[model samples]
Target chain A: MIGSWMTLPLVLVAAPPPPLDPDPRASPPAAAVEADPKAEVPPLPLRDARRAEQAPPPDVMRAADNPRVPKAKPGPPFYDAADEAVFRARFDLTKDPAPPPRTVRMRCLVADPLCGITVEVQALSAYALRAQQGSVATANARTWHSARAQYDVWVQFPAVVRTIGRTRFNVLSMGPKGGIVASDGGDLWANVGLAMRAFFGKGAFAPHLEVTGALAFRIGGFTEGGAGFFGAGRTDLGPVRSPVGFAMDIGVGLGGFGSLVIGGQYDSPLAREEVPESLRTPAAGMFYVGFRGNILWGAPAAAAVTTHVLAGRLVVPER
Target chain B: MRAGVRPLRGRAGVGYRVHAVVILPLASVLLVASLASPAAGSEAEAPPRTNRYLEAPPSSAPAGEDFGPFFTGPPASETSFVKAPRRGSGLAPRLSVRDGLFCFVEDAHCVASLLASTDVGIGMAIIGENGPDLPYAQLTFRGGFSLRPVTLYRKRYHPWALGLTASYSVGTGGIRLQAEDVVETARTQATRIALVNQLWLWHRPHAFHLDASIGAVRSGVLGRDERIHDLWGTHVELALGFGGWASLVVSGDFLDEDTRIVFGFRTHALAGVPVAGLTALGLWAGGVL
Candidate 1:
């Protein structure tokens, strides 16, 4: 009789009535849970669980988007603030969405072997950023190419001065200026020039080709016309003794701020008909030893902020 | 050769001579000292595939595409792409300060050639004559390009690399005349051209390197009254790269009328600060012990 009773309960469990509604969204009957409070709920399938995680409740989504809604309690972070800072610091500028900012500075320009200084305003044009808008993100991120145009004015003091032919001069003074035997004569000149700088590997270094057209004025001593600061006097008032010439110098310099530039300068025909035959210096070539100094100007801060935002947006939690 | 035009013997003076002597030995010592140390990047370990310029693709990089420091393709861009300039395309300039004895038969002068590397492996130099006659007398350009197809990283894939170099120079023919004094007939150009075959043996990331070039040259500049005097000669050079930034060079040109020997040191000046610092550090650490 007891066996018959157990069989009768098993038959009842097997012959349970079907659910009225066949929708997957319907909640499960609570009878089973009520009967066995300790029973574990079955886990969802991988695909369904992923879908559930991706698609939050409408109310929850709205609350998350609302600024006034209070945020959930804080959880443990995958990476520390220091790691994020490092990541931000190392972000490459070539990968930025915006075009890289150019550099501008006021520098002191002094070509050594010559005792003269000038203030110059220099601007460096950024390389064109050709981001593939429609391309894959990986492909867009891989393009790290760069180049720029570095332009500046070459201005000097005292005015332009005429130099002598066959008379060589050092950085300080001219041996003999325009046949006038001044003990120590200096050069007074100004130039407008352009430099094309091509960068290699993250713009840490570059090689540049610079060309300039210069106008040199004449300086006069008590007796004759010369070119110098003290030994020679002013002669810019006289009949256009200023010579127009051109110079080409190829060199390598470190950065926009401070650098050492060493190259050869070819000065082509300073004067021909203006000066006397004894003072005519058609062509002169000299070694260029230049130092560029950026004293007060600081680098642009936009790159850092852009990189920080980029790093934050791109950060992924550690697995 | 023209009259009243004399090649100034030891024209650079004693100060330049002293500087050349001091710099050469100091460079040698530094080179040897750096070579005795450990290689660079040993302290900071990198992931397998980080360096994009390596011959072999980094672990994370795509396979089968060409990658190197100097030899590579243009970047893929969705929009119109302006290709970036490559190295050795006259972008990274190499400057060498040469102080040597430029001799012709019995007469010799101390000359300085501030040579700058320019377009496509050619080095264009202005030979400055630190004399009473003229500031610069000649325009000399010479350089070599490697024939090897591969750009190796760290160490050279092959120890031997063959190259071809050409040298040409034009200047005054031992003549010291004012630019205005010389008429079109009195003006003369001294010209020299040579084709050299260079053999190089180097182990990069280390300091030891040796190269030898041999070639035939035609050098002359003997036209005073519109009379050209050109002659055939042989040119030879042997260079030893000691310091990571400098090299010791010994070159000779043997002609019928003018035979000369040049012994000098060549150093490099890089453009950027970070590059200079990193190169120094890398050379110091990666020096061959």
Candidate 2:
């Protein structure tokens, strides 16, 4: 028991000091012990172990500080914080928390060919970076710098190609109840035409209009050589271009696919001398209705539809 | 009075003949040739206009890198261990079924689906005739088939396409009265049949089409007299399909003294095909322009 008591004092004296707090966030002890002014400084953790290991010995450190001592090639290790600071200054490594230099591409709004600008944006957030890029693409899309010529086609209905008119064109010539005129010189006539179309709307259904002009070929009524309605067999009165024919249509456009339309047409009276004054009747008017459909080219709706069909998406999917 | 009228009639007849034989034909030929010249020219002569929306997205690859190196096989030493006999027959038919039948959707300007590129459609128009009574209207049914032949200055745009078109028109009633209508009477119906060969020109197939055709017509079906006549025709067609599926046609048909105008529509030949439809859309958008 006497010997144990004697050794306890020695053991107490030999015990090592407790380790400093590993976490910097921990508060210091309230009753902090004042550090000795002349005591050797405690070594710091290896924040930069490489530079620490390369630290010169005391004598070399002192020699490095003294310019009088001729230094070897590549010089000596940094002797103090000031020396390290000076070295870092030369290499520009002292700047702390340094992030990579941010960069962005910019362009002029006036469509200048040499307007591309590389901007060194500093400290932009992730969201900001994306916004920058997206805006650039938008600008590019809106800019006319790379604008190319564009052309689009207009399709109209009842596109008129030719026209002719004859007062008795269809009345006395080619009617269903026409056997009354037996003479070969009786009134008979024919007219031909072509048309065009137009549209003014969007989507699968829209309003449309069509105008047509007739291409008149055979237009005069047959001349009656004999007297009455029961004269000789019918004879052609020959072709004439006196009257005019026209047709118009208005209805809904079927999304460039075709049209659901209602239309009417008219052929004017023949004003030619071929027909006798008695046989010359007023212009024959005819009206008919039907549905016509057509395809559209270079239409935005076409592109959207194609994308949807092929990829099952209205827009091209991002990779 | 008769002598005075005779001289006037003679002058009028001479003028009409001159106009028909010279001025009219000359004008028609000039109009068609002028419209078709651009399509006949080489693509290089008139490069397609660029479209901003069609530009390719910007690439992020590094500059000056040789892509060839990436595609090349590894060193011979590494490949030596994998040596094996070639499996496929060395001689294979040059044209594959896929090449003839299919097309890539992204490539709008390619003519890869030639085998299925023939256009066929049916059309209708109103016909007018001077019958025994007031002017009457009749319905005309038309069926057409067309094929594009190879052109000298061909490129992706295919602005100019020389085509052979065969068409048949069935006219009922009117000027050519229906045989049934004339059966009760002493008269016979004069039905007409016509065929056409067309030359097509445009920036894109779906954009515009200017065609001039010459064919033959035969008239007087079920009639006492059957007459055959030479024919000529012209057409201005525009494709208004947003989907590039159909086109509107304005056509003129002339058979001797008879002339007719018709408005019609034609659906794209390959519209029903799987990938070719996309190609049609591309071509309509001025492929690669």
Which prediction has the highest lDDT against the true structure?
A: 1
What's candidate 1's DockQ score? Answer: 0.01
Q: Write the per-residue lDDT of candidate 1 for residues A149-220, one digit (tens) a residue.
A: 122322222122222221111112111001000000112122223333322222322222233332222221
Regions more than 4 Å wrong, model 1:
A1-319, B1-138, B149-156, B175-208, B221-226, B241-248, B263-289
Give the DockQ-based CAPRI class for model 2. Answer: incorrect
Return the TM-score for each candidate structure: 0.26, 0.26
lDDT of 1 by residue, B195-237 (tens): 3232223221112356577777664433433333455667776
* For candidate 2, the TM-score of chain A alone relative to the native chain A: 0.23
Q: Which residue runs of candidate 2 sit more than 4 Å off their true CA positions?
A: A1-244, A247-267, A276-319, B1-140, B151-165, B170-205, B221-289
- Candidate 1 Cα RMSD (Å): 31.0
Model 2 / residue B233 / CA error / Å:
13
Task: Give per-residue CA lDDT, model 2, range A1-319, as digits (tens).
Answer: 1232233223222112234334444544443424443443344456544554554422111222324344334324314335555656888764332321221111111111111110110000000000011122355211111110101122221121111110000000010000000001111122223233343432123344434343221122232221111112232222222233444444344323434445443445643453334223344333333333322233333433232233221122121
Tens-digit lDDT track of model 2 for B208-256: 3344444443332222222222234333233222112334444444444
DockQ for model 2? 0.01
